[model samples]
Every structure is written in C-alpha cells, then in structure tokens.
Target: MNSADGAAVVVGVDGSEPATRAVLLAAREAVRRNRPLRVVHGFIWPLLGVPVAAPAGAPPHAGLRHQAEQLVADAVNAAQAQESGLRITGEIIDGEAAAVLIGESPTAALIVLGDRGLGGFASLVIGSVALQVTAYAECPVLVARGTARDTGPVVAGVDGSALSRAAVEFAAEAASCRGAPLRVVYARPGGRAAQAGEEERLLAESVAGIAERWPDVPITREAVHARPVAALTEASRDAQLVVVGRQGRGELSGLLLGSVSQGILHRSACPVAVVRTPG
Candidate 1:
C-alpha cells in the first residue's frame, strides 16, 4: 500500500519465474509511492564446490557471478523501463539469500518477494529463501506470484491480535486505492459445540468494526472453524491481495514470525502481505 507521504519499496530478484512478477509489482508500487526502489539479488555459489569467479582465460567463476549479474540487470531494467523517474537501484549482495534480504528490510518501507524460487525443496514450503524472508523481514513483506500479481480485493486476516489491527488498516488503505472491497477473516473451528450461552461476534462484524474505525469502504468478513492458515488461504484464493500480520507476539526471541503467518506465506494461492509493525 502507498503511504501518504510515499515510501521506498525493496524487491528480491533471483532469476526465477515468480521473481518477474514480484519485480513488476514492486516497480508499480515504487511508482505509485513515488519513492526509490531497489532490485536486490543475493548471491552465493551453489555448494557444488565450483568456482564462482572467472578463471584467467575462462569466464569468471565459470560465469556464475556474470550470469547472476546479468540476470539482476535484466530484472532491474525491466522494472525501471516501465516507470519514468523511478529510483531503481540494483544490489548484488553475497551470503544467504533470505538473510540478506531480511538485513536490508530494516529501512525499507516494504519488502517484496516472490512466492517461490528456483532452488530448494518444493510442493509444501515454496522455497527456503522466500519463506525465511517473509518470516523475518523488518518491514512488512508482500509475497507475490506471477499469476497473483495482476490484481483483486485487499483481503486481511483478523485474529483480534493487535498486529492484525495494523494489518486491517493497511488492507483498508490498499482496498481504497484499488476501489475493491475489504475482506476480513477470523478462523476458529466448525462442527463443535461450545458453552450453553454465548454472545458470538459475527464474522462480518469484525470487518464492519474495522471499517467503522476508518474511512468509508465496503467491508466483508468471514468466521470459519478451521485451521487459520488453511481457511484464510482458501477463502482468499481468488483475492487480489491478502494481508496478514506477523505473529511475533510478546516475549519472543530475536526476530520470529508466527507459525500461522509463516504457514500462509507458503500456501496461499494469492499474493500475501505479512505486516510487521515495531513493538
């Protein structure tokens, strides 16, 4: 979402199919925010014990660094070509991909990353780097896939946590910008009986409550009894944007995201925005 005074956007590029989508999204956001953009590529030679720099006559490190550099250049070029006056900088950092991205996220208004990547185990976790970055980035992180980048309503997960309140605010602003309805989700479980008497809050009430706190915008809510991550993902599968707060609640160790946020990052069909506000 574009902050009123504009904000910088940072994106992680690793020459993956999903990365192109992230770059495009980040560029668009940068333009909208009217702020600087950075196309970051974190590099570390594969563990094959292979050289990474060019030999005397051979290509540098068998062209590893060269290829990666070219890839980053192309990504940055593509992103910058679309928007004039965009301060798009490309950074080639060495070390673990996820770690560096997290390192740079401190000053970033938001960190943009792909839903998945080329390397690492697949099917469940998306990829290690993407997963780790979303979980620990200093600023809010938006994880996008190529397909989900095009656009939808700004959907946010609300769990009554203070963090979720921040997410709702962010989602409301995004939905307003896109002129889309806001979807608020709270999940518990189904097919179970509770106490004899209860004054349950309607799912829609949550969304309505948040909407009432902000500027007028269409709002919707859902309360289902299922896994928080599962329900949120399934409900927002067709949504354009889904925002959730990082679960790093009280008394946590140095830098940690909640399990639900981490789980949704890997499984949500739509691009997920994990918002983390400083304590």
Candidate 2:
C-alpha cells in the first residue's frame, strides 16, 4: 500500500542514543508537516517465545512488555518535549525493528530513523535497522545523523531520473517548510566543458516542476565534476538535509538503493532522506 494523504510521521525507537535523536528529528518533521507523530518500539521477546511476563512474585511493570511500553513512553515524551503541540501516540509491536517500521511505512507520511542503534557495530556507519528500512520503506526515510543543523540549505542530488525528480519535489517541500533555499546538485565524473552544459540542463529540468510549485523556495543549481557520492557528501557538509532517490541513473534496476544514496546515508554530515518514488 502507498502512503495515504495526511499520514503520520512514524519513528522507531530502541532506547538507543541514536534513536533518541531520531525522535527529536521526527517530532520536528511532524510539526513541520502538521502531521501526527507515531512512536513505535519493536518487541521481539514475545515473538521469540521468551516469557515476557514477570516472575510470579514480581510487579506487572517489571515484565519485558512493561519495559517495552516504558521505552515507547519515553520516546513519546521526548517527541512531545520537542514540540508540545504535536499529536503523538506510541505503539509496541511484536516484530523485528526493521520489519515493524517497514510495516508502518505504507501509511506513514515519512519514516524517521537514527544512523545507528544500540545494536550497531562500532565499525559500521549506520545500523542494520536503519539501512534495511531505508531500502525497503515505501515512503521517504530520513536517517537522523551528524549534526542536526538549524540553519542550512536543503540539498538534493539528482540524476535526471524519475526517482531523482521525486527527491527534488520532496526537497523543495522541505526547504519551503524550513524557509531555506533548495540546492539541486548533479554530479558527473567527466570534467569536459561539453558535459558541463548537459549537466546544467539536467539539473534545471530536475527542479523545473518543483521550482514552479514552490516559487517562494529559492532554488540554486550546482554541477559537480566528481563522483556522485563524493560530490553529494561534500555538499552535505553544511546542509541541513541531503535528499536522494532510492535508485539513480546507471544503477542496476534490481538494486533497491543506488550506491550514491547509500554512500550519502553513511557519510553525510547532516541528515539524509531517501525518497522512493511511488508508482
């Protein structure tokens, strides 16, 4: 199913620091979109058949279920603190983290996640749940990472594909919400002058519709003569968010996410949103 109109912004929390950060970011997005915020925590103990209830003499709140409930409560509280007026709800689902979030995606306005979680490997830039959800979620997935800057342009990477066009649309809306400028970036390897002109044309076409839709949103274009990942990552250094398509041009059609988008998710110095264009 696709995300319906007026869907909520759903965020999965594991009580990890990264998850906590995601809650704040999600709350902000919920306020910006004027949508409700749904905080979810995946409860695996019940699914694993582990006795979730407390021992015979223990208190009800001492059970695994209680702990899961408490986690969701905490996340909800955090989101509320971020924005008092935001409508918030919490849920504890019996499933894996990634699966639960993916299940929520079809009806979510957006899915917000953290770069890493408690289960994250120190060597890995992003957690398994974050990567998995980003690749499979039906809606845009925003991985809150690096510095959550309050001031910076909304950067979007385009490859002149339908998916990239979706990214531009999403980015334009984000920029308008923040009253920030939208920077459209196109990265190509060759530095040939002839290619520069083509790259400029592609960037212009990518933002044409979005620019018209968000006329109040100032738009700028950048043609980078570098690898897609490197160029976007560099552009993200001072950006509030870097938006990219689930898959880009020249990528294998079978791949759920393009290499450029994946790389930005890992290396971006700001939040990254991967837009999965709807059919």
Candidate 3:
C-alpha cells in the first residue's frame, strides 16, 4: 500500500510471541480502518557486536540483517493470516525500537506494540519500549495486552482536560468502528458535595456532542467520587479497551505522562490506548 493513502497502522515486531499478538491486533485494526499495515522490525546489529560494514561488494552484518528481515516477514505473514487481503508491507530499520516506532508516528494512524518484548522480564507489566513509545508518540499508541476475549464497552477516562478530550474523541471513533458502546468516566476525590456537582458538569461537558459525531455509538457517562486510577482500573476489568490521555491535570502540563495514565498502564486489565492531545 502507498504511504500517500492516509496514515498506515504500524506495528513493531521483535520475533516475540507478544509481538505476534500485536501483529494480529494491528492487522485487524488496519482492516477495520481500511488502511495499510506497515510491519517494522527495529534492529541494532552493531550493539550485538555485528559489523556495520563488511569488505567491498560484501553484505554488512548480513546475518543480523537477515534475521531482522525474517522477523518482519514472519510478522507480515501472521498479519496476512489474521486478515486475508490486508494491505501490508515490512521493513527492517536500524535504530532503537522506541525511536523507530516514534519516528513513524508522523505517518501512522496508530502505533501498536506488544505489552512486553523479547528482552522484557516476566515481572514487567510493560516493556520499556512500549512505555517510551506510548509516552512520546504523536499519534495514539495501543499496547496490545491480555487475551482478546472480553466483548465489553470501550471505556474512556474523561476529566474535561484537553488531553482527556482527545481521548474521548479517540474512544468515540473506536467504539463507532467496533459497534460497541462507549463508557465515559470521570473520577473525583470524595469529601465535598459541591465538588461532585462540579465533576458532573465536567463529565457532561467532556462528552457533549459526542453522540452527534458518533450517532451510532451508545455512550454512558459515569461521575464517581473515587480515585481516578482505581476507577479506571476497575472499569478496565471487563472493557474491550481502555482509553486514556497521555497526560492529565494531576501533573504539570510539561510532563509527558501523568499519574493516571501511568497507573492505568501498569494495572489495566485490557489493552490500553494512550491518545495525545494534538498540537
């Protein structure tokens, strides 16, 4: 597929089982969006002691490059098997995995990565690459996690912040595409009835006009006097996907990620999609 035909859905693969899962999920998203799937494998052969250059006319780090190429090819094949007739392409680029994926964000509709990579420890809930990409990517980043067994509403954390508004927009479209209902939630600390009223208004304002844009998506709003992390994490227990802004009001605006986003990332029961507010 040509890059000119809208932004492609990009997935990073590293020859890990989790990466294969990401490929399948990304392939389905590409098919749903009617966009191409670009499967990329970031390779750093020199870091592994592979020579960057060989004698004239000879391939440089041919063995390492070939392995990277094979990884991309396998991911492509798996994507194809997941969704026949999917427009797909594969590339092996030399760079840090997070850097390569983040660089692709400018031309990508969504960046999908495995919750854990080849080097990630089993104790780690999210790999470093996934966390870095999700925190910095210009476009939305979806961390493929947990089994795709639940068929529940698309849950979104809404606080009326600019970033949360972006997350609501993204969640609305995602729900519309999947024909799933949307659950917009706003969590406030308990203690004051006056604050509860204010949060209710915020929740309402955050989701205003969503039904107009996504008329087919049924939306349900919740304003609870609970901790943001605890509320959203519990909502994720049965959600098909949990959507959150890259940053929120809890931290300074200059921060790349807020406490809520980080909390959900570490504890969400379903896949998490982090949407950044557009510049």
TM-score of each: 0.82, 0.94, 0.90
Clashes of each: 9, 0, 0
Q: Give the lowest summed-lDDT range of ten residues in model 1.
A: 197-206
lDDT tens per residue, model 1, 1-279? 445645578999989878888988888767755678888888877544667777789845367888889889999888978776788888888877898898988778888988777876666456777778777777888888424644567788877667787788778876776667888887776667644422135444445456665566788766667878888778666788888887544356544677787777767777788887567
Of candidate 2, the 10-residue stretch with the lowest lDDT total is 246-255
Candidate 2 lDDT, 136-208, residue by residue in tens: 9888999998889879999999998888998999999999989999999988887556543687788878987
Candidate 1 or 3, higher TM-score? 3
Specify the poorest-scoring 10-residue window by lDDT in model 3. Answer: 246-255
lDDT by residue (tens digit), candidate 3, 1-279:
233568899999999988999999899888877789999988877667776455567665456566677789889999998899998999988888998898999879999999998994888888999988988898899988775533799999987888899999999998887889999999887875654368678988899889998999999999877999999989988898999997522255666878898889888888889999877
lDDT of each: 0.75, 0.89, 0.86
Task: Give model 3's clash tally.
Answer: 0
Q: Which candidate's TM-score is highest? A: 2
lDDT of 3: 0.86
Superposed model 2: Cα runs more than 4 Å off: 1-4, 191-193, 248-253
Can you give the lDDT of residue 92 in candidate 1? 87
Provide the global lDDT of candidate 1 against the true structure.
Answer: 0.75
Q: Which lDDT value does model 3 have at 40?
A: 91
